[model samples]
Target: MILQLIQVSKSFGDHQVLDDIDFELKEPQIIGLVAPNGYGKTTLFNIISNLEKPDHGEIMIFSEKNTNEKIFEHLAYLQDNRVLYDNLTAREHLAFVAACHNVEQQEIIEICDRLGMSHYLDKRVKKYSLGMKQHLLLAIALISQPQLLLLDEPLNGLDPSSVKLFREIMTELFNKGVSIIISSHNLYEIEKLTSNILFLHDQKLIRNTEIDVPVDYFYFLSDIRKIETELTKNGFFWQSKNSVEFLFTLNECQKEKLEEICQSNDVLIYDCIQKISKTEAAYFSLFT
Candidate 1:
């Protein structure tokens, strides 16, 4: 098994962040840790990385109990850019991590090149942009060649091209048998990366094997009541944004049926926008 948590709970003062939670990962696969801000996603990652001790629970990684610092050599946690030193160049930062992991200089250079960081590697991190900093952090995490990787909001501030590159690297790592738990608010990108999700809701962990596949359509309609009635009669799941706006999930056949219903009833759909992806649909269903 890659990871296991038993009856883990955490709180600060009167605010209970994480309730008793149990989770397990049996194999190498990307799992998205999803939750609202300040809901213990980072806290869970911290506990797993041994940066913070759990209030009550046992955590196991790679079939052994989490205790020895040496066990973490096979694990990597990519935290926020605050961990980076502004005075040091990207090369200096990477060199520090490489030295700790006993990584060779040639390998460090190759990793920097692979991440497209060789161009500005020698520049001090104080001059780096948010995207550049994210790339540097990822390179630092990858330098250790960890079997298990924990990424906390790694996609933040990345451009489209950079995001694509990150996805490609994650795929490459996953194929190499590396287990990853990445926390990101970008539901669309999360869906693209993995179907498995570990959602934190109500201070507990909810595991989902697959994200919902249905597509959601947001419709601005002229006759809200009529459309609502039709939607209910047609067994379509929907939510009202307002009196005139409604969101519905429909398959191709159901979409055609909806169109026919609107045509027959003269219920004008002023504007229809397809907006939600699988992960987004799941997120809304869970949180909203």
Candidate 2:
């Protein structure tokens, strides 16, 4: 394990936030930290990064045990707010990070270019868009060359185009053997990028399970009564194609239900077989 937490806990004055939370990170994989809002995802990241220490339990890293806290040695954390020096230009921000880790300026520029933020290199961070700000924060994390990367809502405020670009960049980094733990409200993006899940619920870890499916599952919806009526006649079960559509297989006798209903109701079938979006599945699964 690249990172491990043995019975971690934290609190804000009297209220309990994270209680008995035990989690770990294995190298060469991406881990999605998911839960509803206020479940302590950000707090966990803060503890691991040493910005906030846990009230209880031990946090252990594999390679550098018993090391000093001044240098995290193998952990890099990115806060949700894109916490950068607001007055500093992007280039200055990049240069400061590179100097901290002794990474060459040339390499830093290459990373900026890869993230599509090269043009904003000379502009102050306060002037950057939310997406551009995220890009810059991610670049700083990359400079450390960490064994464990902790990201809190890294995709929080990105546009579709930037989200796409961010996914690709993170994928490349994961391929290069960086153990990543990212917290996001965007489960669609999370679904595409992760194999294992660390589900946090009610301020503690409720489940930690590896995904069994191919990350591609069918999502659809038909009227429950209508689908049931059709399925009952045709002898099929409800099969959702995606968010907007559903498909049900029926026996020959039941085949007429869908057709009859559609004709009688005059409701056009918008879709029957669409891709199941990650958010839809995650939302459904959270309840189950």
Candidate 3:
């Protein structure tokens, strides 16, 4: 296995963050880590990177026990951009990393070129925009040529073009046999990257696989009681409702028929939203 976590557990005082977390990633693939804020996502990444020791657990990487120094040889953790130094140039930042990791300077240049950062490689980080800093952080991570990469909110503060660029870079790395675990709040972006999702909830890791299924449409209305029979007869189920509107889930094929029935029954349709993916639906189901 490329990485394995056995019986991982961590607690701070009385609050337990993770409990008996066991996960394995054997292939070169992308994994989407999903969880709410303050749920120890960063803490888990720290433990894997050896920045924090687990209260009780063992971490194995590349078929060997991971040591503090040795793991950095093959594992790259692209943490928050706050770690970047404003006084240093992008070229200098990558040069330092290359020197520490014994990576050739030429290789760093190649990575910068690949990531389209050659133009700003010599520019001071203090003058760089958030998107530029993000690109530099990714470039620094690539300098190590890591086999296992952990990225935390790498897409944050990036523009639409930058986001697309980042996605392309991730795809390229995966194609080159790099196993990556990305934690992001962007569900739509995650959906495009991988179907393998790991959700952290109740101090446990839950694995969910996204599969092909019929898309569900949620209709919002003032009151469904008047047309509840029409909805149930057509396989619609009450999803949620509030003072403003009630929401119900129906098959995409039933949208036209539903509208027809609602029009005839005087059921006002405030809005109708086509659900994107089951993963998104599952995420909303947990929080909403």
Model 3, which residues run further than 4 Å from truth? 210-274
Question: Which pairs clash inside model 3?
Answer: none
lDDT over C-alpha atoms for residue 236 of model 1: 78
TM-score of each: 0.79, 0.74, 0.78
lDDT of 3 by residue, 154-266 (tens): 88888888888888888988999999999977778887889888877778877655323345666777567777787788777666656545454544456667788879888
Q: What is candidate 3's CA lDDT for residue 128? A: 90
TM-score of 3: 0.78
The TM-score of predicted model 2 comes to 0.74
lDDT of 2 by residue, 1-288 (tens): 777788888989987888887766665788888776777788877877767888888777764432356436677888864478889998898788788878897888788888888788899888878888888888888877887788889887788888888788788888888788889766667887875667676667754443222123222334444445544575455555444555554322344455566556544555444245434454456645
Determine which window of 10 residues in candidate 1 has minimal summed lDDT.
206-215
The true-versus-predicted C-alpha distance at residue 192 of model 3, in Å, is 1.5
Candidate 1: Cα lDDT at 15 = 90
Alpha-carbon local distance difference test for all models: 0.87, 0.70, 0.83
What are the RMSDs of all candidates, in order? 5.9, 7.9, 6.5
